[model samples]
Target: MTETQRPLLEVQGLCKQFPGVRALHQVNFDVIPGEVLALVGENGAGKSTLMKILAGVQPPDEGQILIDGQPVSLANVNQAMDQGIALIHQELNLAGNLSVAANIYLGREPKRFGLIDSRAIRSASAQHLQAVGLQVSPDTLVGDLSIGRQQMVEIAKALSIDTRILIMDEPTSSLSQGEVERLFDVVRSLRDRGVSIIYISHRLAEIEELADRVAVLRDGENAGLLEKDQITHDAMVSRMVGRDVSRFYQRTSTPPTIDSDATPILKVTDLVVPDHPQHKVSFEIHAGEIVGMAGLVGAGRTELLRCLFGVTPPVDGDIQIDGTYTPIHHPIDAIKAGLGLVPEDRKEQGLVIDFAVEPNVSLASLKAHAWLGIWIDRQREQVEAAEGIKDLRIKTPSADQIVRYLSGGNQQKVVLSKWLVMNPKLLLLDEPTRGIDIGAKEEIYRLMESLAESGMAILFVSSEMEEVISLSDRVLVMHEGHLTGQVSGGDINEASIMNLATGIQAVS
Candidate 1:
């Protein structure tokens, strides 16, 4: 790409304001043909808001968007698509009940006449899927596919459009390492075909790998733009956060205490579920310890967490809390027993989007705000919610701001705050850092450490091998619902963990 080449999309003086705060402050950005422009920002930095404006999910309160050097108005999603702009959001927009082909060709299905053309749609969808390296049958229902496959279907849908500029928001957040590589390949092919890509992601490595130019946004404004040669992880971090974060991952080691040898806080024995009956699972997590669960997708990692959290009942198992065995038949049982689960899917299960930030943060411990046997104490709730927001560095105009308006990272913080209010003896975190920016991820890591130091037992589950290895005191590798192996001390690493996860017997 040369400096003389015209940009496919140009945004100037973009601004968006809500009731109390300005979300975007005269933001300016542009994307050129056949180039990948990485948009880097912390949560609440207005990246999503800007993208929504470009995609016509919302119109900008101020500024102009030029397509091919001509001012244009994107009134709605349909108009945006007609103008060759497509956006794949972090939360998938696909209907799980529909087939892959149907989802890809959803509203714009090809028709021979004025009637439906299922055959043509299926054939076109198959071609698009192949272009994106997705091998799933076009007729397969999207709900049955894994998160990674569903993401591929989304990319395939975008590819099927005559997209001049595509916005991908955290596309690889849940994808496995192999799947990420495949996605990168697809992106490269799209770039080669002269499609401009506006890539928004938290994964710095992915940005470095796929972006031709990196643009940093801070406090709703364009901080700076660095060419590929000048872009380093530290540089991008400093730009996005306005401070040097050299020790982001460095945690002060707290020595194991006398209570470490005491009774286990959470004990799962012979836990079995209908979806995964291959293994009789057993694990014990003590207070003041962070136990990590590592595995590939479909290895039953999530199922194990779900069962323990009472989202799915264990067919046969004994759960012991504080030396007393108990049966958990529902989530309420787990909650009453001092167990807090921060679910993997924030939008679907963890958050009530329509609710305000304060309400969402105080959800798990709302009973604490009861003034009497009948009345709810709004003052106490607001106080606790304010503390949570301040403690977690959650950016919002006010505690009364709707959670749906916050960015992905801020939303995750609200979820964490909801659980933290309970002050549980045990915490179950499944992909806690999913879709959050690097700065927010660092904050979450520090928060985890602080919680552990406070004698809270955390069972952390993540697909990222590095996160698992860096944060876990003991790594439990799972394979097809079975405990494949356990890595402690020096035994935990990418290669060693991968060996156990892939059934290559290195533990023996």
Candidate 2:
């Protein structure tokens, strides 16, 4: 950056260390005023650490943070806000039961005659909401709004506090396509008004579309920075991974050979998910095939998986494992029928983050290895953990390392290890590589390929069009709870899948 173009926010020699993990080390970056600075990184790359430090959620072990060329003491979140800085986390932090106006002015309401000025809050909230293009009434309950509208409320809340530097962390991860476009419009408008934004997202397409410049972090350090002209997908991925992952997802497993009368590994015959019971879905996966399910955020893909895994009961359906009708009303029944699921929110549903890596790996299989069906089998757990650590290349100092302390990629590996140990006939993966870095995603893809080659049936869901197209031998497109199209080989392009996903096409 030119000396005359002074940065609005600057970090130098920043460092953060956790037990068995160095989150950030000597990280340095600057954000110019009125510019949207995109931060890209792999899991455990220290992006979160740096963001936390900047927002004063945590103090760095060593470093200097400057605002407008002067060092500042941001010992707390309030102090950070006092300096016109605000953070919007990936999962929004908003009270659902409160009204929009009340939520916006929470903890700092305007007062008149020693009473809260509700009218003033509503008027100010309306202006802020308009600024972010939210048309909801100020008195609308926050809980009643859609996820996209709630996000706008978050931005409005930041504005209510007179925020100048807004940090958005994965803001679009939950939004629909239309919502994302509207958000981009608001971001550009904010930048035009001289509001500096630090944008964080794993969606490189978004970075390319919105960022004036891109800064990449790898292993808790600055990997590289790219100007607008240099902000291609390949450039961002290469920097984030410290290597070129141009061939990002390649399916190496050949198609499974099956006769017409062969019994498929998994068959869903007129399966009815409770979320979309009216739309009966039917599909089947052969023993060695990898099937990809692609759809929009509310397309019922996740619900289908939940039903198949017995997490959510289906309304009416027949699930056949090896051509035998199996009723999976509970997770144990699904497990006994040789099925496993790695949920999208691996942190909450898949792994016990506070527990050690070894325990997480053997969690699902512990019952099978237990002695007398009641006693814990310590020896089997230890052996399984050690093998998983080595086989999955989980980067941990030892088996006892807490899953929470591991990088996003390693945490995901632990979750996968849990299912792998069960040796299930059919595996279900929901957004398998959602929060991981490109390198880790590639590793997971390799594992999937290897598993498929070994005759394991795999069904996976992905929001990323690239991942769905490149990894799956067959793509099943879902729209509004309906399995609209099944594309394979020569017909599985983005346009075809999107046509079905958007309800413009159907299998019939």
Candidate 3:
């Protein structure tokens, strides 16, 4: 509010550089003691780099960090933590093999008589978890818990520390609506108690709900900061991309016109995964149609997609392509059958970060670039990669640029390009636009529309209700692993989807 109420955390002249790129450029930002300051930008805009510098994961090439108005140098993570700075990265870093309590109080476990006090640690962890409104047992294994619970554990771990500043990077990306509400409550309580939070999220709605001030970054520089009242979604989008972006989910009004009696490209009858036996899913995707899968988190939307892609074997189901039933036992089998899956977790499941963009896009179609004696044709590979990069509008220095260096949206495009190279008859896209900026999201939506227009059968899965309603010709809603209802045309709005997803109506 005033200089007298100076921010508890001040960053000035922050600069970071990699081999061929300047990741961050003289970035300056501040966070008040009792307010949520949102750090937002497009992928590779240096948001993560700046946060990493603050967390001591990376040292800034040139910068001054003032904590409580006193200059401090953080050489490593321990030093950062000792200075009361805690960072929760986008990727969960918990020890899956350990108990939640163990993971929470990992290095700073309570000791009694020169021995680890397991009971004390568990009790403290439980209390911190409860403070965050998470109802998970301390003894539960981290891997055994859902992604949402694992995220809660991460937050609880941060709270267990004597943290003056908490940095959360996309904290609610994987959370359901209910879980997000609980997280917001915890964040509010923490803010009232004088904890400075640097909230980073792509969801503009969440920023409006949680952030007191918003700092925008673009192309490794500070664009500007907006007060809560002045920040609108449109303004934020423009700031992030340096241009005004229109409606992100722009779908055509033309109805899908697949031949009514045309043979089904993909037919799944009584699909049931072992983990989800209750879901007796049956669906048919016609060639040249984009079929939308709409539902809430844990509504078996992703699970169904996985089953269709053979990520997991379905216990009782028959998959037929072009009127011929085929048994798919693994992803390889599915791919051979002209089916491609763009998994939900693009970073983990879709792309190999350490590899270059060319390799990633060509990974699934290596055979196409192979020569005599199983030797890879480097020239052919480059040609294919270049085509994909241009077609997908992937922003990279070149196809040789590592995917790890690309932005989130670019990485997603690479994943899509990878599958597109396979020339699949059926393409399964799960939450394709998650964590991407509005401009990039619109580009992806356009690509999907174009692909469907090209006579490719696409099964689109998205958590955004508006996306589902606008993009899909037919919407199938699932609840607790069961296909509860299907809506076509105008009936695919939020209310109808919610009603079906919550089991308020029967499938027709």
Give the candidate order by descending TM-score.
2, 3, 1
Give per-candidate clash totals: 0, 0, 0
Regions of model 3 farther than 4 Å from truth: 1-4, 135-137, 506-508
How much is 251 displaced in model 2, in angstroms?
A: 1.8
Candidate 1 residues 1-508, lDDT tens each? 6664778888999999977767899888788899999999888788888999999899999999999889999989988998899999988899999999999999887887888899999999999999888998999999999888898898889888888888999898777778888889989999998989999988887888889999899988999999989878888998999989873365576535545558999888888876787668888888888889988877888888888888898999899998899788888889989999989999889999999998898787776557663567788789889999999988888999998888788899999999988899999999998877777888899999999998999998998777888888888998877888788777778888988888765445
- Which candidate achieves the best lDDT against the true structure? 2
What is candidate 2's lDDT per residue for 1-508, written digit by digit as tens? 5864799899999999988889999999998989999999998899888888889899999989999899998899999999999999987899999999999999999999999999999999999999999999999999999899999999999998899999999998789999999999999999999999999998888998999999999889989999999999998988887777875577666767678898899989899999887899999999888999999989999999999999987899799999899999989999999999999988889998899988899899988989999898998999999999888889998999999888788998999889989988999999999877788898899999989998899999999999999988899999999999899987889999999999987655
C-alpha TM-scores of all predictions: 0.94, 0.96, 0.96
Instruction: List runs of model 2 lying over 4 Å from the truth.
Output: 1-4
Q: Considering summed lDDT, which 10 consecutive residues are worst modelled in model 3?
A: 247-256
lDDT of 3 by residue, 1-508 (tens): 6774887989999999986668899999888888999988988798888888999999999989999889999989999998889999878899999999999999898899999999999899989989888888999999999877788888889888878899999998888887888788988998988888999999998898788999999989999999989888888888998987774566874556777798999988998877689668888888878788877788888888888778888899899998999998898889989999999899899999999998898898887557863888788779889999889888888888988888899999999999898899989999999988777888888888888888888898988887888788888888888888789876777888889888877546
TM-score of 2: 0.96
Candidate 3 TM-score over all chains jointly: 0.96
Q: Which whole-number lDDT from 0 to 100 does residue 388 have in model 2?
A: 90
For model 2 the local lDDT of residue 421 reads 91
**Better model by TM-score: candidate 1 vs candidate 3:** 3
